[model samples]
Target chain A: MTRRSGTAVLVAWLTLVWVGLWGSVTAANVLGGLAVALVLVRVLRPSPAGAPAVVSPPALLRFVLRFLVDLVVSSLQVARLAVGRRVELRSGIVSVQVPGASDTLLTVLADAITLTPGTLTVEVDASTATLYVHALDVGEGPEGVQRLRASLREQARAVVRAMGTAEARSHPTPLGRTGDRRREGQP
Target chain B: MRDVLSAVLMLTGVALALVAALGLVRFPDVFSRMHAATKPSTLGLLLITVGAAVRMREGGDAVALLLVAAFQFVTGPVAAHMIGRAAYRSGAGAQAGLVVDELADVSAPPA
Candidate 1:
């Protein structure tokens, strides 16, 4: 594994440990969370070989800030959905094609998608660099799919840049094709 | 106060578990079923563990509770992801609903 990936794994493990022991020692949790956050900030160090060759720190900051805002907003939306009637919630799967060759980029994309409230990553085909997301609410026809793809593409691009792998940009894979419906027992 | 908290946590945990089971049975798709089972179930287990820790009449039980809670939290997401991936791989998902799936690019290998 590359040094960056190794760093990622270590950071992830530490995050897990902190959460696991959070309530046990109050001071430890706070210090551990901060310490882990700092390590992540440092370890996500960018490499020039990353696709696009331009890793923008400001872009990453913007993406993270936006993600946090979206998280809060989506949480409220989910709560409203839970208390109110079903409304127009259309839960369905959508696929996305990412442009990076590295596993780190793909994993980051999946985790980012899952972190959002309205969407959850159902499956990811790393071999093909494709992602499948289950959305809680979708608009009419292809609009929802288009929006999902747009959001994923934007986020994936930002994450790849943050990870410092700008050279891995490949072709934009078609989101999901319409009329590719699968019925059970149609193997 | 400790007794009251323990009782509340136990009741909440049990109630959440029952709801998760009901959701698992009632959901239309396997992905939804897994979601029902994993998320709420993990939360339920966490609550139960915390309650046990709080009500720990002995040190052994506290250690066991912490261990079990840690185990469940770590494995729950992995298990859910595996089940969802399996379901999607099996071509059992509903199409033409919303969102695009790119898995169509990789042809399904013959079983």
Candidate 2:
């Protein structure tokens, strides 16, 4: 409940990692981990200006569950794509506008997308609040591109809802519309 | 019964790792290759760790295995993120038949 609880969490996680790497949980290992974790937390503490948003536990749980499902599904999809004889690799970059998200949230969103199969985050343009994602199979053409953009936007929105502040939710941009319009005008 | 379960888990883990290795060789591009490298490999490693923990049947070992899984979960995405960024910056994605270039405007200086 204290302000240092966040650091405590980081310390606990680091301690666990240390124990895991050591492959034992002896008293010495635990004490060493604790000492290391404390020093690390002190040295690498987050700045007040870059404080993470208060996460909604229920929303975060939902997001995690859905993300797990997506991970399994996409892994299978990628596996199939890799092995399939007809390699229809329509790889492309799609831009998504995510307004009101903090730096932490935006980085989380990019990491999530990259971790999922068939997609990688290419660039994050902070000025325009845009994320460029490279997808393995963007499908046929403009319609397929629109569908991918919509899904990516939805994923971004879910992350925002789970971990973003009310200010972020208020200034919502129209999902996929701007990109869709631009694609439509393309020959 | 425990032995049987451990054997099954180990076999499944090995199978997954083999598939991941196959995908690494068979996949055409770096982005797709990265996809093959991260997800299944992490799951495979977790499953193998769990199988070993089950066989060990020691509380401390189990806890250690759990920690291993947790660390893998934390680091896998980070590693993938870095690799993807490097590949994109190096124009590997474009060489792999990239259809659209949304980041062209922003990432132009690097290329």
Candidate 3:
């Protein structure tokens, strides 16, 4: 195994072991960590890469700060919804085309959406680089869909940027007449 | 004050868990029920775990509690993703509110 791949495997293994050790000081826990680490290392068997280990501490810090901000904001938003009076929430699902984003960025965005209240990631299509998010409290009519799309676009951008990726310049995926199915006359 | 805080967290966690269970039982659809169950349950579990960790005077138990929290942090999203994907593919999410899924390209039958 090349050194780069070996290091990647080592990092994953070490993280698992650390998690195990950090969980409990008991002998059993320590042993468990060792066991888990061994299994993880074998399973991942990461391939080595030629790219130098780029240490971007600033990027890492930014990522952490972004995550914390999302956590607090989403928590408060969800709490308010959970407690406040019902206001006839206009919920809808919109798929945003996210172009030029890596797999890692996509996963992070999906996770962030799921963690946040009033939103869930229903699906991601890597082929077209689009993500479908189910949103709660979208306002009524065409305006609402536009707003919902914008909000998801903004949040998804934040997630990708936090992971140190460049802004996605992808075009919006075309949806047929079924895209905006809601109408003023529809029941 | 600490004891009071612990009691509150414990009660809140239990309440959330019960609400989640209720949602799972009463909700007509899987997606909505999953929405109800995942978020509150995760928050409740985290808060309760933290409370317990704080109450633990010993180092070992505290470490264990931290570990549990970390595990939840990693696994919660994974489990949610798995369930959501399963539901979407199984045609259970057809009734979901407001979606523009273009995954038809990816879902094409394997060549």
TM, every model: 0.54, 0.83, 0.71
lDDT of 3 by residue, A30-76 (tens): 56666766676679865433222323467557766766566555555
TM-score of 1: 0.54
Kindly report the TM-score of the first chain in candidate 3. 0.63
lDDT score for residue B68 of model 2: 76
Distance from true position, residue A185, model 2, in Å?
Answer: 15
lDDT of 3 at A57: 66
From the highest lDDT down, the ranking of the candidates is: 2, 3, 1
Where does the lowest 10-residue lDDT sum fall in candidate 3 chain B?
B102-111
Best by lDDT: 2
Off by over 4 Å in 2: A1-5, A18-35, A125-129, A173-187, B109-111
Q: In model 1, how well does chain A match by TM-score?
A: 0.62
Docking class of 3: acceptable
Residue range B32-76, candidate 2, lDDT tens digits:
787788767777777888887788866777777777777787778
Candidate 1 reaches a DockQ of: 0.16
For model 1, how does the per-residue alpha-carbon lDDT over A1-187 read when each residue is reduced to its tens digit? Answer: 3556555656666665565545354667757876876676587754422333334678678777876565445444443443444354466676666545466566656655654556667777676566777776656677766776577666766665565354453333322232122321122
Sorted by DockQ (best first), the order is 2, 3, 1
Write one digit per residue (lDDT tens) for candidate 2, span A1-187.
2236556767898898787778777899999999999888788775532434667889899989888777776667766765677575888878887766767678778878876767777677665567788788898878888788888988888888788755566654634346442454531
* Model 2 TM-score on a 0 to 1 scale: 0.83
Per-model CA lDDT versus the true structure: 0.60, 0.74, 0.61
